[model samples]
Target: MTMSFGRFDLNLLRVFNAVMEERSVLRASQRICVSPTAVSHALARLRELLGDELFIRTSTGMQPTARSLAMAPLIREAWKSLEAAIDPPRFEPYKSNKRFTIAVSDFVTMVMVPDLLAQLRRDAPLVDLVIRPDSWIDLAEQMDLGQIDAAVGVFSEVPARFGSSSLFAYDDVLIASSSRRFGKLSLETFSHLSIAVVSLHGQHEGVVNGFVAERGLMRRSEMFDRAAFERTFTGSKRSPRVALSLPHFLALPSLLEGTDLTAIVPRPLAKLLVRSHPLSLYELPYQTGLEKVSILWPAWNAGKAPQDWLRAILIRAAEPLSANLFDFVRPARYASPTSQQEVAASA
Candidate 1:
């Protein structure tokens, strides 16, 4: 029972992984293109060698034991490392039917996804994309477990094990219904009006002074520049009240139309919304620092061809928008009604 590494079979790991993923002996056999009898024999050999029942048959399905649960992640990571070492480093985007999963915010989906999809369709017709919300509490864990390939958003802190690249930078701007014919948004007037904000966690407060630390990941749960808002109203008696806290931007336009509610959002997203909706963009009464939107991936995937290819496409897609971001953030007083349309067209 005390077998050395030299005598241990590596193929058994493949069978184990298949069973672990499928959670059923018959399904696992089908996944590996092996007969159920061979899968059963392999499992038996592994169980005997390890002195543990890795999985137990139950009414639901093949349930993994405590030992299996403990070993699964390590075994899977080891197999991935082995495969990466043995396999040739190449990715043919045009011919291969590969699927990539990305975690993104709704703002990024609105501004960037269309261009990304257009380029992807032209360059890699067979490649597929799966988009997940960035608000998931387990986003970092999912990335570590290989369930998510990459994420796009503003990360306050990225662990050293991950690699990041800035796609673009933006600042905050205020938006209101154009019908209001609002003049300059002085600090006093801005503080008096009701405000709407896109809060991923539905938090009422707009002041996110620092990152929300959760499970080894540092993320921004609030969408707007809350710290700047707090600084602008440090000692004011009538501070701005967040009248609405919505989860996504889809309902923001309808909610703001013909209403006194104004929202503080990223400059780029504000420009996009103003072009289509009856919204008017305004410069924040107080200056806010710029925030960079970035894409993050596992550090180990740095030179992998698939990751490199996807990164290249993403950078190319964002280049035009990045170049014109300054136009979107210009002072609202100096901007003309048609400026939003022109900038949006160029982007």
Candidate 2:
């Protein structure tokens, strides 16, 4: 039932977009400031014009069908263009109350958000922040669906179609209990020792895993660089032994306690861990190269005023960061060395 272009009204698309975002006809009506009856009428016209049951009412809510899911992103993009064309661009953070959602890894949540939140408090008091766990969100799809404003973490690769900014760069390092006889480790010791590799899947296992299970997509949570690790011992016969794998980093301090296992973690995390516990940080004998964490957003979001402001704030915050604060007995550059504590405290 493809209708002739002459009979179509663009307002029908707006109604459809609102419903898709809210996932409820009643809530969608409130979002658009219209009545539920009017929403139903517009939806009926849209269904007839599109020749598909766009949404099916169920016990849960207005569940979008296959056709609706397929068309939602396209329609959202069109509606955004329409709004931009008709409405003048203006965003005042102090006066405007808008919610911004960011998809981030546990690493960023632990290391970046503290400073970011403090800055937001002074600058955008009216704006609200929502943090989505990146390991559980199909970040690429979430950005496409307009569910997340931006993604922040170390990514191996981000699709070229999206917009991104490099926030900070970091390398991996080795962490172990201080009491261990091995004051410093050699390549041979590294290969024989039991290692704990952080697996994102292991962190968000049962109930938490279900957060993304309902959606048909997958995300890579762990940030280990196996390629770089193996490349260091290219010609050597000794291979590293992996004894255990856990998902989150917060527990590594306790897990490595009284055990012969050493955990590999980002140098920034190593900085924080050594401060709180009787732990030692050492340079990796194998060269797991630097990973640059970036803030990625949808192309549709590029140049949007409020989003741009927030992005700028993140870029500024990451300016003075360096992950290898504990690389030596005293930070090579930080003569005072206490500045390492200052950087760790920033996180």
* Top-lDDT structure, candidate number: 1
Q: Give the backbone clash total of model 1.
A: 0
Model 1, 24-79: lDDT tens digits are 99998998899999999999999999999999999888888989877876787788
Candidate 1 clash pair list: none
lDDT of each: 0.81, 0.73
For model 1, the stretches where C-alpha displacement exceeds 4 angstroms are 16-30, 35-74, 203-210, 328-347
Q: State, as a TM-score between 0 and 1, how close model 2 is to the true structure.
A: 0.83
lDDT of 1: 0.81
Candidate 1 positional error at 129, Å: 1.0
* lDDT assessment of candidate 2: 0.73
TM per candidate comes to 0.84, 0.83
Q: Model 2: how far is 180 from its true place, Å?
A: 2.7
> After aligning candidate 1 to the native by TM-score, how far in Å is the CA of 282 from where it should be?
0.7
